[model samples]
Target: MAHLPQVLVFGPPTIFTQFEPQYSHKYHFLNAWASSLPLDQFLHTHNYEPSSIQAILCAGGGTPVTVHVLSVLSSVKLIVTTSAGLDHIDLLECRRRGIQVAGAGSLFSEEVAEMAVGLLIDAMRKISAADRYVRQRVHSGPWDFPLGSKLGGKRVGIVGLGSIGFEVAKRLEAFGCSIFYNSRKEKPFISYPFYSSVVELAANSNALVICCALTEQTRHIINKEVLLALGKEGVMVNIGRGALVDEKELVRCLIEGEIGGAGLDVFENEPHVPEELFGLDNVVLSPHAAALLKSLPLICVTLWQGI
Candidate 1:
């Protein structure tokens, strides 16, 4: 027991609790820290006596772990995250501090992909709008809403063909959609048609879905030009980072009818969506719950064990 390493985890309590039953006797699990805690307070409580800690794990929301926090815990060897996304962590700082960082890849890919497909279908078929009408008891109006478009035989464009993007393409294929993709590099295993640029893909497809990672290079990649290319007949779905799409441009596009509609599970400024979006009936929005499912607890526990 004395030889085991002490690992401090900063995230939800459930993450540590679920995994503790399996590995508690082997390693020490320190008190959990919420992501909302100030960095200074977090460090004061968790790393004040840094000698007792040998590793750190960040498993909460997309908060950047500052270099100052890393500097205080010089003895920490590795940092493990339960999420597949790494944009929240400072990779350069970790490399400079010689702290290894490992993330869960492909673990949440299918979950996110399924959510994207669901949003796409809802947007195309106006499911949310229909549900709203029923709840409001607007029964007097004739059922003359514009006909819904079928996903079959439509040109579907996918941005970023990583694990999640591939999964989305596979599922969309079941509906007989012709898949097209744009990525930094082409994948040989994917049988879909490839586009060299996002603009071209948006201009050609009936639906455009964003599944790319959030990075300096990809920030606001889907701006006004891309939306304009995806004219009023085209629909858009974003299950990726909200920063990947320009919120201002999206709002303007939706208001001006430049594009048909959008299905969004994330936003540029999370937990604080723009007030203007609430009035638009064309958009379907969620509070970043795409990756959260009943299976998340089990998957998170499995990832903790491997970490």
Candidate 2:
């Protein structure tokens, strides 16, 4: 009988372990966390048979795929991640080492885009707020509820024109939104007005849907200046990673009415949202559960094949 190819796994079991029952018969997964031997010791034992360790599987942003980790497993040529964002992986090191990487790609884009749009509308329309108002039994005299801004004719700016961002643009266009985008560079095929600077994008937009990847260059991309550009009437929806926006600055802006409103699905710190946002009605919050794809398990089934 032939032995299955070896794969080194590192992440919380909830993520990496889900694939175990499906792929156990097909491959050998060496879970780093389950090993009594330290990860360094485990890799050292494979020095002579480095090629046996051909793949490393990591949870999208849960585990850090540092250069050191890659270097230790010298012969690993492929990395399969369960998430769309690669911010957690050291791409520079992967490039230098000539290792290939693949992510969930377009499979996760539609769902995330849906969440982004939902948040955008909720921020603009105050759906969550209205729901809370009803639940809290605030039905009195005049039923004084502020009117939600209409979706039609709103100028929207998408920070990244990637798969998820493109999907968002398509959906919003159906609702009569004018789509503009700012990306690393202009994609000529796209007809939407392109801005080189996010600040400029915000200045012209009524709402900004943040779908950009989180990187060193993009960290705090939506800073105080950008928020100021977005102005007091502008709404912001962040379905992307938390660090893409300055959370502290966002909270302050929402508190001081510097910006109109915000819808946040991801946060700088997971499961720990700012208590200040809790009391604000203008801000809509989602528990980062928006993109937990229903098809995720199927991805694990075909993961090895995709690589």
Per TM-score, the best of the predicted structures is 1
lDDT of 1 by residue, 115-197 (tens): 99999998888889778766777568666655667878889999999999989999999999999999987888778888988
Question: Candidate 2 residues 106-198, lDDT tens each?
Answer: 778988999899898899999999998877874566576788888788999999999999999999999999999999999987899999999
Error of 1 at 289 (Å): 2.3
lDDT of each: 0.81, 0.84
TM of each candidate vs. truth: 0.86, 0.83
Which candidate's lDDT is highest? 2
- Candidate 2 wrongly placed segments (more than 4 Å): 1-19, 28-54, 71-75, 138-146
For model 1, the local distance difference test gives 0.81
